[model samples]
Each structure stands twice: as C-alpha cells, then as structure tokens.
Target: MNQNKSGPGTSLVGWNIKSWLSASVNTLDDADLELVYCGSDVPSSQCLSLVKESIPAWQSRAVNFDEGDFFVLSGQQKPVVIMRAKSPTEAQKRDAGLLAPSAYGQARDLVGRAVSEVRKFKSQKVNLRFESCQDREILGALVGLELAAYSYKQSVAAQPAPFPALGLSVKAELKDEAQAIAMGTNIARHLVNSPPNLLYPQSFANAVVELFANVPGLSIDVWDEARLQKENMGLILGVGGGSENRPCMVHLRYRPEGKSEAPLALVGKGITFDCGGLDIKDPAGMRLMKKDMGGAAAAVGTLYWMTQSQFARPLDVYIPLAENAISGKSYRPGDILRAKNGMTVEIHNTDAEGRLVLADAMAVAGSQSGSDKPAAIMVVATLTGAIKIGLGSDVAGFFSTDEALGQVISKRSQEWGDLMWRMPLFDGYRSRLDTNVADINHCATGSYGGAITAALFLTEFAKGYPFSHMDIYAWTDGERGALREAGGSGQAVQCLAGVLQSFGL
Candidate 1:
C-alpha cells in the first residue's frame, strides 16, 4: 500500500489492485486459492470431481450443505472454497431488476463473503469461476471482491501492517466498469471517514483541488468568504459565521472536446462538521457528525469516475462547504438571510443548516441564462433524519419534479445496486414553509414531513429547471454485504454515476 498525501491533512492510499475476467483454465492455475459456486441441487460435476480428487470427505459435506454455507478444502498446493447458493426461482429472476435484496445483490454479497474469507487465510491472489451466471451478477461479484479489500486507517503510531496485495480474476468482461465504480465508492468512504479536525471546509477544498489537479479538461474554482460576501450569499455566510475556518464553495466544470449540449448541474451539501450550531445536538447525536459531508464526497467520487473513464459529457458540480459550530458570532434563529437569488429566508432553526448552504449553491447553478443554463439539476445531501425514519437507512429517498426523469433515475439506480425509493414531492406540503416576516421560513414549524418540506423549500430555489433531490443516509450503521464494516456507505455515487452515463445513451 502506497499513501499519497493529496491535501493538507488527507492521505489517499492507493491499493495494489488488479482484476479481470478470464475463461481459460490457465488463469485459475496461477491463483493460490479458487472459489466455486454450487446451487441447491448439487455441486457441478467439475466441482464434484475436483472435490473428490482433492478431499474425498467433502462429498458428504457438499450434500449436507445449506444455502449460503461454505467449506474450505486446504492442505493442498491450491486451496478451494465451495459456496452453497440456492438457485433463484423464476419469479425471483423476473423481479430481480426491480427489487432490493435481488438475485444480483445476493450474488454480490456471496462473492464478498467468499473474498473476505480467503483474505483471512492470507490468500492474496484468488480466482472465482462460476459454471453459469449473468453478466450483471459477474459485475456485482467483481465489485464485491474489490470493495471487500477496502480498509481506512490513519494512525500516528505504528500503523497496522497493510493487507497483502490482492489480484482478483473473475469470468466476465465488465472488469473495467466494475473497478471504476468500486474505486469511486472507496473515494467517498475515505472522505467520510476522515477526522473532523483534518477535514474542515478549507482542507476539503484543497483535497478536491489535489484530486483533480492533473486531469485534463476540468477547471476548478474556489470562492472564499470575501467573494461569497461580495456576491451577497448571506445564507452560506450566516451558517458559516460561527466557525473560524469559514465557509466556501467549490465549482468544478468538466468539458469534453467538440460542441456539447447544455451541461448537467450537481449541487452537494458540504457540511464538514455539524454541531447543530447554537441549537446543538446531544452528545449521542453529534458523535458521527464528521460524516455530515457525505453528499459532497459522493459528488466528488462521481466526478472522479467520469473523468477517469472519459465519460464524454459536459458537467458542472457545485459544493457549498461549511462547519456549523457554536460561537458568539453564530447566526441566531431569528435572523433573516438573503440568498443570492434575492429570496429572503427567516431562520426558524439553526440546526437546519444543510439546506441553507445548498440554497445559495443551487441559486448559483440555476443563475446561468440561455445556452449556459443546465439541462437538468440534481442535488444530493444527507439532509433529514425524517427520510431515514421513512425509508430506513438501507434505502435512500429522492424527489424529482419531472416524473419521467424520476422514473429513469429509479430504473438506473436499481440496475446499479444502489437502492433508492422515489418519494412524493407533494406540493400539498408547500404551505408549511410560508412565513409572515420573510419570503419563506427556513424550516417548518413542526417535525411532520420534514423531508418533504425540506425538498419543497429547495424547489423554490431550483428556478424551474428539471430538478431532483436525493436525501441520503450516507453512513452504514453496521457490516452488511459489500460493506464489511460500519463507515461511509458511498450511498449515491453508483446511482448518480449510472444516471450520468445514461445521458450519453
């Protein structure tokens, strides 16, 4: 493992990764370990023959194996791990593309489990050979294998010895695409896992600059507090006033060669640390506030993948970075702030600060006129606890102004294994944000439908373009599937990347 110091206090470690799909038997011959999948009926003849030759006692073990069970045959030149996978019914196969915990998802998890098991035995190189599998399943398996090797730890003392270099070989052709998506996901995880002291607004901006410094056709711009004040972005400045580190916005533009259509705009809420300001959160609630910037991490990861894969589409990303801390200079609940789009917002609660910074960034995104206007706008944020209550932490909730666009995004999300549910924008909730003193109240009076009201508040600043807002719980609460531990889940990176790739189609 080689650590690359990309920013002031951030280290982006590069994994020694090599993954590809091969059909030839010669490929498996070189691997120290091999994984074979067995359906419910019985192990395949090749698998049985290998088992009998290598370890005859395993024949009875295979017959008694239950679904998701596995047995490792060791003490040979090459070790073999046999996994028992129940064959999916016809109904399961038909509905796999439309539901969570689908066959593809199960395959990914199974592969991830097998890969993790091999790593425990100190096997650095492995091969996975399936008698029969879909391309999507193969892709999932590759992604799972790559992601299973991800671990983030930054210590000043003697660091734990790095995991041995992993070389994964599968039997599919989607290695490049799967590797790109996994890399993007790891990028998000790395950012979200960084300590708050090392990842404030200024350092966050520096990380973005360093990540894309040498990439061609991408321009980066950072707006300081002075520039933000000059532009009258009071909402951003107000929320950031409590912190000495200050608030800033980073705008990234990627333009490919030749004439391109209007670019798509992505706005991310980059609250590096949210102590809930003067309206502070309790100790238990504030323990994981370091992941408050997961939305920005997803956006950064998506852009990084697009540039690396050379996805030829014009795109612009807007990130409003801030820290909602407590101080004498903190913006109060009664303060009314003016957004760049000339709308006044009465602060009802200082804790609801994510939407305030996003309001200004979206205003800037929608400010362009004529040919410069974005074709569509998408905003990503870990915006509300209400969404988690409604959809649970495993599924993200999104609201879109355009029904057709929403449908397309939903389909793309399902295909990529990043689960998202389309929540109603519900114009009926619009009245909740109305206030007597200012143009609108920053937050609703009550907690009812907090997610919907928040989306409605943001819609006011979307400027009538085709808009969608994704409310994500970006932190994984525990170990599950491809995620082997609790940390950043890289929630929307895969889904958003799928949406962008669909644009070119």
Candidate 2:
C-alpha cells in the first residue's frame, strides 16, 4: 500500500477529496479526523478502536439508533464524526426516512452530514472511513460531498468561507468514469447558475469553445444570426430578434477513431433567458428564467462526459442559443415564421419559443441523417410548464417516435439514477397545431396535453426520422438526493450519456 500524502487535495470548487479502502489504513493518525459508519449494532472493527477510545460517552447514545443520526467526537485539533450506517434493506424501505430510493442513498447521505459537520467546525480537512462498501458507493459519496459544497457567488472579492478537504477510506481504484460524470454535471450547473446577462447566445457559444479546447475528438461550429438568416432559419431568428445578443446554432461533433457508424444527433434548447417575448411572463414566473438553457447545458455536459471518459462513438450535438426577451423588434403573436426545412409556422403564443428554436435546430440535425449515416435524433429541452404539471418537478416527461429508442432511454434513465417517464406522442394530437394561414401553429390552442402538442410540433421538422424528445424541468424544487440541489440539476445528461454508451456497446 502506498503511504498517503497530505497535500492540496482535488476539490469541486473549494472542498478537497480523497478516497481509500479499509485495508489501506496504516496508522491511527489517519483516523485523527474521521467519519465512522457502522450498522445499528456498531460493527466491531480495528479502525473503530481510536473512535471508541476517544469518545465512549457518545458511543453509548447509539443504543437506540435512527437512520442518518450521528454523534460528534472531539479530537485534539478537530472533531471526529461517527454516523449510523443504514443497511441496504433499511435504505430500500421508503418509510425509514431514506427518501432516496437507491441503496446508495445512505452512503450519499453520510457525505452530506460530513459536509455539515466540516462547515460547523470550520475544519479544513476531513476523512471518510467506510467498511464493506463498493467502489461506486464511495465514489457516489465523494461526488455528493463535492456537489453539496458548491455555491455560486457573483462577487469578485475573496471567498468568505473555507471549504473542507475530504479524505475517504476506500481502495484507490479506477475513478475516471465517476469523476468525469461529476465534472460534466458541475459544468452544466455552472452554466445554468450563471445569470442571463453573462450567458447570452454568442457568449454561450464562446463558452462551449473554451470548454472543449483541451478535449480531443471534438469539433465545434457556431452560426451567428446572419448565417442563420442566410440558411432561412426564420423560426430561430423570429424568436431571438427581440434580444440584442443575437441568435446562434452551435454544432459539436465527436469524431470516432477508425471506421465508425453514423452519429447520434442531440438537439438542446439554449434560451439563455426567457422573458416570454411579446407574450410576456409574470414576475414570479420569470425569476428562474436563467435556467431556460438547461437543455443546452445538459447536452454540453453529456458531451463533456463522453469526451473526458473517452467513450468511443460518433456523436453530433445541435444547440440553438437565444434569449426570448421583449423589444420593439420581437416577433408578435400573429407572425408566421419559416423553418430551415422551408415549412411555415404560425406563432399563436410567443411564450412557446422553445419549440420554435428547436424546430430549426431539428431540421438542421435531421437533414444530416441519411441512408449512409442512419443517425438517430434526440431533442432535450425545458419546453413547457405542462410537463411539470403532468410529471411534477423531479421527473422528466419524454416522447419518442421510435419505440426501441424510447425503451433504451427509459432503461438507461432508471439505471443511471435519472428519473424519466415516457409520454405518448399521440399522432392524433398533431392537429392541435393546425393553422389556416401556415402549415402549423407554434402551440396548441387548448390547455390540455400542451406537453404532447409541443412535442408533436417537432416531428414535422424531424421528417419521419427516429427521434426522442425529453421535456425536463431541469431544476430541483427541493432536496432530492446526492449531487442534486435546488439549483440546476443537470437533469438528463447522465441518461443521455448512458444511452449512447450502452447503444454503442
């Protein structure tokens, strides 16, 4: 075993992290600042000797243990944490206060508690000691700690508080996949956390270029408003005309090594801010509009993950970047916009601008698919409040034109811990977008099945290609579980990444 060195640890923003297994413990000094997890009976272990000797008084309180309950033990310089580790069966029982349905929930919750204790004591470094845990479990805990430690501040001044350095007692092993996924998620969160003023269309495109600079097997192409106009993408131009920032489409391609099959195309909505254009939105409804580009964030994050993890596949992502704000130049309710595919759309509601931008983007992506490539198209967006009303805030509603693709997405979502529910495309609902003046209306007139109708509107641009659409809430309303907070959840990046990874296999 290699002797652990005390140095500047790798952190998400400010929190340092370390991982180890029980067998790697070489000294009692390592347990000087530690978190001990044991079952209700307190499993007997040699590592716990120091913890037991140091705090016999608090150890007695474990006579009647509750899940997630912990007791703090004082050390010479710092406090030691002793937490009750819930069994897998106990964690699965929802009534036991383990709200996260997965078995890994207990381990993740432990990290959350550790972060709190570290903050309370203002400790600069802490260690997590675990027994009989898998590598993924420990990785999940560390990922949780990194995420909980993240806080976005707009100040240029020095940071107010210190973030703790974490040490984990798990076998040093391959952590590339876990860390890459976490990094991707953090990328999405940082993008979503940025205020709209800093993340407008052109700037957002620049950010993607900067992020992918060091990454290999990637190519980026961005089209400004003029270029979009030249391509006759009137839908995108119409929606973004109100904002001075201009509208753009960014194409990121992941070129595979050697001979590979057709690419899987991903389309994400990049509305930097949705002021609801001429239709306008309520103040309360517009407060969180900074996350309007969450779908784009997710797509970017997934690409980050695949590239960082070196997943072998040819992939293409199309992101339509814009800000749906109100101004004299904004498209109004009665305007007809033409898509890149030469199809005309009547704008009944300017608030339904997401689908409009996506329409042109889908056309751009779908047009690239042919007999030689046979690419599959998938669209991700925060398209409607109706999805939130139907599936609530935590779950995303997805619709797919192809059944096999839908099943693969659903399976991957569940496996990756991303919650998704499949919604019906309902070809019968296509008429909801009918308009006398144009080929289609931007939105359905009636209130019912708005999510369905919005998805149905995209199929016209897809042009009978195999496509899947995910309408994600993209922000957590309350605490859900590990790596999830009230801010940007980076919703379906994991699910999308997983599907592409598995499909390639």
Candidate 3:
C-alpha cells in the first residue's frame, strides 16, 4: 500500500525512462536486450544493415517475415529481438489526418508482446528503437512497454525475489506524456485489483487522500455519514446501509492560477464490492464483485494524469464510495429512496445498485452555479451487465445528451485506441422506468434495453447540463496485446484524457 516502493512486494511503481536521439542501433547504449521494430514498408536488407554483427539464420528468416512475426537472436554480446509491424496504408493515413500516421495501436501491441517475450529470458535492462516511426508511434511504443512491465503481486504470501531495477531507453521523445498516461493507467489497475477487505469505502477515501496529498493546486474534500445525512444523499446511504464500513463521497478540485474557464465535472461509481444487496447474486456472478469500483479507479487515474500534465483548464471529480453487502439493513427491491436532487426513485431490483450511487454524485456534479458551474459532466460506471451483452467485454458503450460532445468523444476514443460506441438514449424506453408509487423507478420493468434505461435513469439527475455516460466492462477476461494480464483493463482513462484535452480548453 506504500505508494513510493517498487518491487514484487508492491505494485509496479514505474520505469526509468531515458530519451535517446540516435537512430543507429550500433550507437545505442549496451543493455541486456535490444528490441527493434521493422515496418512492412522498410526492406529486410535495410533492417539487417543496422546490426554490425548478424546471425545468418535470423537474417534469412527476416527476409520472409510477415506482419506480427518476430525473431530473436541470443548468445551474442546482447540478445537482439526483431519484430515486423505493418505500417498504415495511404487510406488509413488519410483518414487519420496525420502526415505520418502513428499506427499507435499496432506499435503498442507489438512493443508489449516483444517486452513480454524478452522478460521470459530474464532480460531486465532493455533498449528499443523503431524503423520508419514518428513521434506518435514512439509514444504508443513507450506506453506499451510501460504497461507490459507492470507486475502486481501484492497478495502473494511470499514475495518473489525482486528482479534487478528494470529500465528502458527509447530513441524517441514524449517520455513525460507517455509515462504520465501509463502510470495513471497502472494506478487504476492496482486499485481495481485490490481485494474488498482492504479497500472498503473509508479505506478507499483514505487512499485517494494519500495519493494526492502533495499534488499542487488540488483540494480534496470527503463527506462522511453526518455530511451525507446533512445533504440528504439518501440514495447513496440506502445502498451502503448494509455494510458497517459506511458510505462516503470524495470531491477533488484542480484549479491552477490564471484559469477562469468553466471546470469539467467527472463522476464515478465507487461500489467497493457488489454482492447484489438483499436480492443477492449467485456465486459465479459474485466472484469478481471487487472490481465494481473500476469506474472510480478510472476517474482517479484521469485526475492524476490531468494534474501531472498541468492541463490548461480547471477540473472537478466526484467519487461516491460504498459497498452493497447482504445484511439485515440492506436496501431491498421496491424500496423508495430520495436523491440529492430531491427526486424519488423506487428501487425495483437490489442488483441494480450502481446507478443508485452514481445518481446522487451526478446530481452534486450538476448543481454548481454561477461562474463555478461546470462546462460539462461525464460519468463512468460498471452499472449494468446488459452493456456487456450488447457491446461485449472489449468495447464500452456510451450515451450523451449533447450530440456534438458525443461525436467528439467518439472520435477521441478511436484515436486513443479505447473502443467506445455511442448508444441511443431511446425516449421510447423511458416509460419503462415510470412507477405508480414514486416519481420514477431506479430500474426498468423488464430486461430488454437495460443499458439504455440505466442511462435514462441517470439523465434525470443531469440538471440539463451536457452529460455523457460510459458503461464499461472494466475487466479483461484474458491477456491479449498490450493487456499483459487478465485483470482491470483501465478502460477509459486514456479516452477520457483525450476528451478533457478536446474540451478543457
């Protein structure tokens, strides 16, 4: 839990990133391993000429190498890895609007897989150089390397012997930006991977405080049970009443000097554990409930990135922390609760508790007045399984009240390699949430279009502000490409960072 340490006993802190300008491989510093990426457009002979001494077998094989193919040569002064990556086609480059399209995703995946392979050979210190790559591609490659190097063994009983201090030297720029984004992603991953017992509401709030204790121009405020009661946040209290840990809210504001633009508001659902409340879930359904707070982790990561990068605009982050456990005090189906906005909601199903907590946080986010009013509001949560069924586990589905804002977010998501598709906020399904007993129902009457209905439920609290909601899976079922493990995917941090950059100005 100590944020400063780096080793197997703790989460992977970060890498020692060094910048290099020399393109020649022979001029590179000596390391245990060297990774070189060869683009499809580059000739095999041109790549082979970079190395002073070459293995005949590797050179022969490189001639026929296909995209995604790689070869390794060991037993020399230092091991050398050669990976073949495809460059963007003319049409792809034209669509991207970059003179030199980065092929950011392809570079990221290739570098990540190459790093994973070399690590198996016990190579710690590594050097990377790319052929025919621009700064964007280099940024992607650096992010990929940083992500692949992450090793989380916090729960291991006997910590494995620490490897030599891992370091990476790349012949590129953007070290600061790449490191900031990657570290933000790893921070989110670490928080999501933590067990529930160690990360309840109070502990989660404390961790956020500790993490941002030294951040300049940032102020953090936490609301305890008394403050929740004073503010009449009955929806949050109702969802967290079953647990002894109690529920709370954390608000973070980052306002740098000479910045008078409206602040961007971010809201995240911080359900530390979701056991489905009184309705309860089957064992299989409850196994990975600890990751229910993945949205909060993403929000935390985004804030960290924005502050570290010194973004031009002010920002506000609201996190509602709670646990939906089973106990005598747990809120049950058909219960009526009042939100911070004074809207009555009838809970039709206890399993749908994520929306209950997020609604109150969104209400607070949209309540800012005067010059302090938020320019826009964005909410992220793992609120419904219907999203997973509709978009699958790999893609996140989003809904927005403003069309222009939604289009910009969609475009940014594609550029950042965070796949997000826009879902319709069908007014036809709004009727499903109507109930005779209350102003509205927290959940829809039936299962069809559940994700749309969930988005509708939160829209009622948006206060007419430009609002966007992202429903993400947040957990990767298996390792693939840049995702080195089957754990927290860190789904929306990068995309949200892009969103802020697009609108924060």
Per-model TM values vs. the true structure: 0.88, 0.84, 0.88
Across residues 79-143, which tens digit of lDDT does each residue of candidate 2 receive?
A: 67766555446554443332233433455556655666666776655666665556545656655
Better of 2 and 3 by TM-score: 3
Mind giving the per-residue lDDT tens digits that candidate 3 earns over 75-169? 25777777666555677555344222336666777788876776687865566767776666777777777676665563233554343333444
Deviation in Å, model 2, residue 8 alpha carbon: 22
Give the residue spans of candidate 1 off by over 4 A: 1-30, 37-55, 63-66, 69-78, 83-97, 102-104, 154-173
Candidate 3 off by > 4 Å? 1-28, 39-53, 62-65, 73-77, 87-102, 154-173
For all candidates in order, the CA lDDT equals: 0.78, 0.73, 0.78
**Residue 466 Cα positional deviation in candidate 3, in Å, after optimal superposition:** 0.8
- Comparing 1 with 2 on TM-score, the higher-scoring candidate is 1
1 Cα displacement, candidate 3 (Å): 18
Model 3 / residue 165 / CA error / Å: 6.0
